[model samples]
Target: MIETIYFAGGCFWGVEGYFQRIPGVVKTEVGYANGETENPTYEEVCYRNTGHSEAVKVDYDEDKILLIELLNKYYQIIDPYSLNKQGNDIGTQYRTGIYTSNDTQMKIAKNFLNKKQQKTDRKIQIEVKPIKNFCRAEEYHQNYLEKNPNGYCHINLNEANQYSKSHLTPIQYEVTQNNGTELPNTGKYNDFDNPGLYVDIVSGEPLFLSTDKFQSNCGWPAFSKPVEKLNEKIDTSAGMIRTEVRSRKADSHLGHVFNDGPGGSTRYCINSAALKFIPYDQLEKEGYGKYKKILASNF
Candidate 1:
């Protein structure tokens, strides 16, 4: 299905750059969203008084890039706890927000916000509103990073590049590094015979197993739960639509989490780029200490 997300996090340029580099984002355009005017201009938005926030509009494939994953990335670069400020950039236009296009986006946005609130001890000031009109930014704003690798922007490539240093294969680099996505049902794991835990592709963190996977018919891998700590703060972001899931450790693209799953379930549909699986028989041989206990308990 076609999905859009609008995220605002101070200085649309940097936020745009960050999202443009992620996988599953079909298109990335810097724009002005959630405002009163019919079509607010860049200069008008600069005043930070048109009720507009400098935001990024992201066109993504839901099957490839989950909303939860995008939101998490939005939080990584900007401080959610702070109000209308990201590092040096500060203004009403720089404020955080999630502008929805329809009832489904609205519902998912609210549910995500609620989950975020419960996890954080601080109060949330993120604005979740219906999108009014989205005006695309000047042509120079599009692919700012690609045009000039060392251009002036808020995001630090060193921080992002650190995650890219995981020795990913050529295809992994093309997708994760270039913001491209693997076609649905074309990944190696989709039809693998190996059955066991899937570790983090970059960090090798034990995340999911074949047994825990359930067919969501969503053309992606879905798991009931994550192997990591549940309270991890997945950030909320506003863009072409609003997205909510991003990983900080590897900075690699991860899938989204949702309350809706098959068989009355909660599914965390993840990207294969973010994981590496360990077959059940190879668990002990791979020096996994005692993961045999996980297999033993099942029987």
Candidate 2:
């Protein structure tokens, strides 16, 4: 399913460009959102005090990315505590805000902000509210960064690439980023089924539980289900059709899911190179103590 969210982080040029690189983002358009005037132009928003904020309307596939993951990425590009400013831009049009149309989106945004507030002493200046109005910016403003490679952008577009290179080995990067499969029967978790959690190697987000694992004899780690939502898409590569599974937050290509499994359950065949095992004993030490109850219930 496709969902929409409006993000007013700073100059729409950088905000729109950054989200375009995300895996599940289908499309983005620069616009003025939640403004007082009707169809306010970029110049009016900037100089005429139209009460409009330069925002990007992002259309994303929920099956390929979660809303919370998008929010997490939004937080990375802008300073939530800064009021009416982001990077070098200072104006009401450049203020930080999250405008949503539905109750679910509002709740998620509020919860995310609340949790973020608990982590710091400063008050979060980001506005979270229902979208009042939106007017698309001029044609030239759209895809500004793509058109002008040397355009001024406050966001660091290379952070994702840098993170992948610094945190993952060559094989891990290959499997996760390029969808290259590991050799069958050669993965570290192929025959290992200790009590623990399997997390995405890139983002460390909890994925599969050890209790859900079973011996599928498929020469890879197999699980009945993941602990959280996973992004899935139709993969028609190598002359075969399959359902590809990916980590929602990091958008890493984990592996695939198949219908054939024990007790009519679906089998999530995952690449060990895409995951990092956190043993049950080390859950607390690894800051995954909140999941202890989930692991205990299975026992």
Best by lDDT: 2
Model 1: residues with Cα > 4 Å off, grouped in runs: 157-299
Per-residue error (Å), model 2, residue 28 = 0.5
* Local distance difference test, each candidate: 0.68, 0.88
lDDT tens per residue, model 2, 239-282 = 99999998765668999999999978899999999989989998
Task: State the lDDT of candidate 1 residue by residue for 1-299, as single tens digits.
Answer: 55887988788777777666554565678888877886777788887478788888877768655787777666667777878887687788888898887788888888888988899899777888887778888888876765655677877644444434545776666554454456677666655545688765653446666767877766667778765632233544333332233334334556667778866678876666656777788777654536667756764
Candidate 2 regions off by >4 Å? 162-299
**TM of each candidate vs. truth:** 0.55, 0.58
Per-residue lDDT of 284 in model 1:
73
